[model samples]
Target: MANNPFKYGTIVQEPYFTDRKEELATIKESLNSANHLILISPRRFGKTSLILKAVHATKRPYIFINVQRAVSTADLAELIVKETLKRYPLERIKSFLKHFRIIPTISINPITNGIDVTFNPGVDSNILLEDALGLLEMVSTKKERLIAVFDEFQEILTLEKGIDKKLRAIMQEQSLVNYVFLGSQESMMTSIFEKVKSPFYHFGQLMHLKKIPFEDFHQYVQEGLSAVTTESNDLAKRILNITGCHPDYIQQLAASVWDLLNYKKLDREADAVDTAMTQLIAVHDLDFERLWTGFTKNERRILRDLATLGKLSSKDGYATSTTYSTASRMLKAGYLIKTETYEIEDPFFKNWLLTRLS
Candidate 1:
């Protein structure tokens, strides 16, 4: 009779969100100490949600920008200017940004007074990037500490050569601003932040999001699906195992199972879970197909081995490290995430792979 409590396809907020207590604590500690951090995780692992939660919980004056679609460094400047205006008034923010010798054109709509920002098409993009980071510095001066989050921060790699050097140069000067860079692509993120050759190498502490532990996940589900008549606790464990304890998939699978029981009136828990999984796989068919087709023959072989064997080590079918490297590139790209052992990135994807090869 009630709406499904489990949520996916968007940000999962409080009450509905499962345990991230330790993560929250760590994030808060970083913010309080004015430490810059790289919040790294694979796509859909809830990096955005965690960032939002941590920012809100800290109650700091912050600008959150997602530069995932930014086409150039100039575009990135416009994005930061727009997002900064969203948080602080245009007059106030513009005053701070105006100090920069190379700032974007900031304008307000005549009727709505909504802020819009842009840069000259002919200007050097590096200058635009410098001016953008300068704006953040100006704002940080207004408060004891300002929090700035650039979600999908790894996407900056495509902007221009030495963007990292430029960004690092500007950001390292901010003594009062606490910055959190959230990125979904672990490989690119790591390369940018961890490699010794990187400008951002050791610039900030690293935080990798692990899958929610089974005990915590089990308890969270049990609490949410109250007044359980069936053995939903056992079902929760199965769901976690099936989904590989992935943050988004756990919510997705839980939602599917909940939907079957609530709306479809599925009486059997097993039946509900099975139907849920089938429907989920249906939704992901095209995605999995694209992924499967993208791999080369050798890559396909590696995937088939992974799907068939469930793990990539100590088996007769075990491929050598070099053999796996070609496929393992996907691991760096976050297509395949590492756990206690090597496996496919997505559990449902493994199922789809099995179906395709079977």
Candidate 2:
């Protein structure tokens, strides 16, 4: 059997990457114009993959950092420096570090042959962070324009009070590099970039990423599945409907369906879809259970109501202020999303909850 034609849970490259022609063009144009970009999207919307593709299309060297991975200001500083070093040699970065007051202890990891950087304990990491940004700007000036992407940049708010100010200050002075800030949390990202009182207000061109259109996504999935299944068109529509064209889940569900049709010898397309959905829920059963248990009694009630009602509102047994508050909190935490009305984000989770409740 041919290998699965779908991919998820990591950066997807060409052939596997679906249509984002317009978004890809816009990002390349922004990069070429040296405009800093702020891209906002909910989780699993393919923001990272789209940005990386644009950067690669422009053939520019990039430093990509997942801000969520950093636990503290110091860790963030080290991450920036380490990514910079990966793209350049230590000899080149040494001169830039000399200008800063706080010099980090840099060593080579014998196992990975990668650089490991650390600062002394009790050092003011905010200062170290500032110096690190300054160093990046300095190094970028010596070469072609660099693209520095900070994924989940809203986490900076939790790292330090003034870190946003420090970042904006450094970014304003940077001329040779194009900065791309990606965020998953809509409210926090808006608070950082859109609000007037925030340090990054009017800092860059803001772009809100949305889900792939159903038609385009359906075509991609259809083409991929045609390699293995004779019923590609019907199966493609089922996958899109199941995933709501969510980039990550679409690929994930399609992969499962492909495995069933190719390896399991499933002759009926409907059975493949049903079997894939069942398998997906079983695989994520533990995660869903943990999430369900983590919620308060009120939150779980709201989840059940949203799944049953299809679109939740105060008229649908949510008359109390406490219940509304619980739904609001769930929305903020990304458990629910609002379109025409509020609904659960994960379709499989909703399916599991419905089965359990029934």
- Best prediction by TM-score: 2
Per-residue lDDT of model 2, residues 1-358, tens digit only: 4778999988898888988999998888888886799999878788999998888887777899999999899999999999999988789989998887889989999999888988897898878888988877788853578889999999988887888898888789879889999998877898899999999997889999988899999999999888777889999999888776678889989998988887856657668887899888999899999999998867877898888777554654556787767777787799986555777889889888988888
* True lDDT of residue 192, candidate 1: 88
TM-score of each: 0.91, 0.91
* Superposition error at 240 for model 2 (Å): 0.6
Segments of candidate 2 deviating more than 4 angstroms: 265-267, 286-290, 293-298, 320-325, 339-341, 356-358
lDDT by residue for model 1 (71-95), tens: 8888888887788778776668757
- C-alpha lDDT values of all predictions: 0.79, 0.86
Give candidate 2's error at residue 271 in angstroms: 1.1
Q: Candidate 1 regions off by >4 Å? A: 109-114, 141-143, 227-229, 286-290, 313-319, 355-358
Q: In angstroms, give how far residue 207 of model 1 lies from its true place.
A: 0.9
The candidate maximizing lDDT is: 2
- The positional error of residue 217 in candidate 1, measured at the CA in angstroms, is 1.2
